[model samples]
Target chain A: MADFLSAYSIQNWLESCPQGYLEDTSYGHAVGEGEPGLLMDNEVLRNDAIRTTVQLVLGERCALAASSGLINAAPDEASKRFLATQTLDEARHVEVFTQRLYDLGVAKDDLESVLSTHANPHLVAFADVLLEKVDKKDFVAGVVGQNIVLEGMAFSVFEMMHAVNSEMNPKFCHVLSGTIADERRHVGFGENRIGSLIKEYPERKAEVEQMQKEMSYHMLATFAAAFQDVEAINELEKIGEERSHAKFQGADLGVMDPDEMEHLLADTVLGEFKTRLGRIGLEYQTPVAP
Target chain B: MIDDVHELRTDEFLAEVHSFEFWFQSIEGYLSDSTWGHDADAEEEAIDDEDRDRLISVLCNYCVGEAAALEAASGMIQIAPDRHSQIFLATQVADEGRHLEVFLHRLAELGVTDADAEIAKRASPSLLVFKDRLLELVSGKDWESALFAQNVVLESLEFVVFRRHAAEADTITSQVLEGVIKDERRHMGFGENELGRRLSRSPKLQQRLRDFRPELDALVLATLKETAHHLELDAEEERVLGKGYLESVERLGLLG
Candidate 1:
């Protein structure tokens, strides 16, 4: 009996977004805050930051494409409007993250090249799994792929990043906070809008669950690849700089190693994906462990 | 459906188009205005029964049209020439969705229980043809032709429709169209700059663009003729549609 229309209305978006959660924020971060001097001054730190931001840019770019592509495929006007806002949110994500790459010293002209250079094959495969559904204009599968799987992954990823950067990177942490908020809204929309839809078409559950399975494998692989590069973590530890005391989920980022953090992030993402998919009437298909 | 087409050159208006951050700021400026955020039924008391019925039927037709625009804008994001263009189209997709939402929200307030049924019942045949043509163009590989169909042809028609209606609309209707009209102008600016740049580069494309006109012009005129009857647009409004299209093409440097 909830008012679905009003909840997703542009007025609501206006009040809750630019006028609400995002008030006075510039480019999804605190105004005038630049990248930390430590990141700017150190070659190893800069390169590591650029690598991390490249993945974010790539992920956000995929998110932008998926959200925009889902608009036409959405069944109801409300869903379309929500997807539209999500599209902008995703585009903003791409922009802010791409800007972070610039802040990390990637030139404007070298952006595409840098993005190509650092492109994670596993992440690319993960996006391909979701984008295939978007391209086919499959609304149920697309939303499940985008809102539930991709966004759910993003929510945890941003939270983990936010926690890790809170001590040394205020600017990047602010950016992650905004994206974390946006991802939360997108995931909520997926659950609220797609639950009834999944109920109405019970047969779609199996196919969508299969997509989740495939995407999950690639997502886990992406995490493994990211954590495999422990040079930056090792380098940071050697610097004897301020460490992040933040806790992501139940894991203490200040104490966890790269492998442990990867496990924490991957487990948390898939765990939420299972819960969200279950709420929307789709049984989670467990992927072969990465 | 017509207004004074701005005679600004490419550089003049292209300077206004920025990334999504700027677009959000522009919208937020409007949101902070006193005129925005009107309730769905803000105009309900102002309209009579006869006018309300006509408004619902007419707005239903617009709901269909805006939906087509939303679909086209969404598809354009994938085919846009570069990251900058894709980013811009992403914002357009959101604008089109907001337009469709506001129109549908208004219709629902006017006692329209099922918007799809109302749209099917009330949408003019010419408008449906236009929608189908735009969709077909958008689905193809040619980004220029698709951008032309949506930004130039489709958005121009919407501009006219919104402008013509806002003049006689109640407070809520005017509020909706006010924001939509501004967004349409921004869309037109992008079309002119991007298309003009392409046209200036390729004489072949300019010729092909000029050649692609008659059928779409005929469709626009037919839709306008149909809309004139439904919305009671005067002779001047009818005349403005053709003039606006001409001015747009000329501004895009395709007139030669």
Candidate 2:
């Protein structure tokens, strides 16, 4: 069987995933940042920032779920089978994140409204372009957009979240860890399949490279929109400092500014994207210099 | 234990049909079979060079249809609402892919290396129309209409064509068609069972299906007429094949 057709490997990965990632709520109590009644008590401004972050995550996952529907238009059997498993994986991610928002004091009634109202416009636009590629049955373009670009950006955000929250919110950290693992597998499948497609039709190499260039611009725009508010940066910095203090016992670790951290995250993600594209026989130029 | 009539059935149909394994083994076995050329001799003796070329054209046309079917099956996997249905559609994807491979291989054996391009250049007009309509159906949000268009109308016509050709085909071609027909029966069974359950729950859906039947009928007949003209069949042969196709459709009760 082709590697793409071997969904049993993904099934094994899902089965062997560590517990507490999907349905554990006990760790929420361990993190004592806010009162349990933060949502009911209208005094917690930090909860607002948390709700916005959750809404951003929710929007990305929902876009992923919608894009999975277009994977059925792939031309080959192996690709179709592999993407079927991916569709289910994306749906599960949506469910996990939606439930996580509910557990984090975002009321169920407010979840969808928050997501629709607060999602970054650039990120949404980026997702729409990727989905439109799939709708047009441009298979290579879709794979590059969703798996390489969107998922790569997502992997970076999840890594940053996991690193910051591991000390403060272990429950949320666990969820991020599981999601990161799934995203890695998704990126691997994309690289492998896109490699094969490029090998078969060498002309697609230029098209894919152009797509990567366009997606990089969208990624920058998304990051800029996300960090435009200085208040949001201050909130994130406070959370980072609190978590760092909890993890390191009064050690004088020099603080990295939020703007520096954002740049580092974007660079790390784009670096990985470029390396993967090169490995798959497509050359990608950095759209924005580091 | 009493059974609920409304309960969805979940049989191990994939295992029973030996979906992938059967096609894989049959194709590998047939491609290397030693008696492959025996049928070629029989065919060459039975038909002159002109008739032989026409028969090859017909075979190439079927190959194109199989390729289109493969695309439709792949698209259905995304829209299927339930796990069982999705799994079944995935198998159909594999089935159609296998059918295309085997047909192309057979065409190659008949010394037609560029069969796909040749047939595309002179593709039957009606088949192209039918394919366009089928793609439109599958691409729409209504999964039931896609199922009805594919398995009931298109596959039913395919079943008739395969059966007709199996009677007059060379030995190896007949053997391949045998396996293909068996798979088609399973696919048709799935479409019937699923569509029946859906229509039972929604009177509105049933009415919609009733209204959509004639359009499907016209497409099927148009394709059949093209096939007859391509093969230069007599008027009697065309009427008999047309009647057989309608009987197959009526048996499925799709029109009602």
Top DockQ prediction, candidate number:
1
TM-score of chain A of 2: 0.80
Each prediction's whole-model lDDT (CA): 0.82, 0.63
Per-model TM against the reference: 0.93, 0.56
- lDDT of candidate 2 over B1-256, digit per residue (tens): 1133235234444322322222323333333332222233434335567766776777777876776676676677657775346545655664565566557656766678676477777666777777888888878856988888887777888888878777776676777687677768877777777777787788888778778888877877877777777678778887888888777667645555
Please list the Cα RMSD from the true structure of every candidate, rounded to 1 decimal place.
3.9, 11.1
Candidate 2 has what TM-score? 0.56
- A248 in model 1: Cα distance from truth in Å? 1.7
lDDT of 1 at A11: 63
Q: Is the docking of candidate 2 incorrect, acceptable, medium or high quality?
A: incorrect
Question: How does chain B score by TM in each prediction?
Answer: 0.87, 0.81
Which digits, one per residue and each the tens of the lDDT, describe model 1 over residues B1-256? 0122245454323323547776877777675552233544454556778888778877877787788888888888988878878888888887887788778777877788888888888887878888888888877857999888889878888887778788888888888888888889989878877887888789999889889988788887887777776677788877886677667666776664
